[model samples]
Target: MTAPSGTTPNPLEALRAKLAAEPAVVDAAAPVVDAATLEDDYIVCHCTNVTAGELRGLIHEAGCSSLEEIQRCTRAGGSCGKCVPLLTEVVSIELGRAGIA
Candidate 1:
């Protein structure tokens, strides 16, 4: 099969070929976390019944920058304020993931 004109071959194919020619290397200490197993729908704030997905959406889509703003938007940490820390952590994770902070 002919490659597209003026284009290079697939870099992934090249890597596969190179790996096929090399000895198998095993690293038992490598960290493995199943992303699918990660909880996203758990209630972050029982007072408002806000889920992690909802908080993440607020941070990403609504552009919430702080826990206060998140509280204003989603009423997450507005009650007993026990979930403020978790709310703050969620905001940090979401904003960092979006490269906003």
Candidate 2:
């Protein structure tokens, strides 16, 4: 791999590697829940206690169209970063529901 051609590992790359290696984070066979049926108390990020409703609000009301914006607003995937993919899925659903591009 040529040692990544750098003296120090990139933080973002390191995070990506960690997430990729985390098996318990997400299961491919697990069923995905429809965003439309989620209640306000339905937690999307357990590490940060963020709910689907909050994410919906961020998308619909605050106009957060990207995962970066959502993270900055509520720190959903800031902890272990495991909820990132699911959080992203939920964000897309909410955006689609709100008719935002």
TM-score against truth, every candidate = 0.57, 0.63
**What C-alpha root-mean-square deviation, in Å, does candidate 2 show against the real structure?**
12.1
Runs off by more than 4 Å, candidate 2: 1-32
Stretches of model 1 off by over 4 angstroms after superposition: 1-38
Please name the candidate that would achieve the greatest lDDT relative to the true structure: 2
Candidate closest to the true structure, highest TM-score: 2
What does candidate 1's lDDT look like per residue over 1-101, in tens digits?
Answer: 34589998888887888888896987533323332233778677889999888877887787777767778888887888766666666667777788877
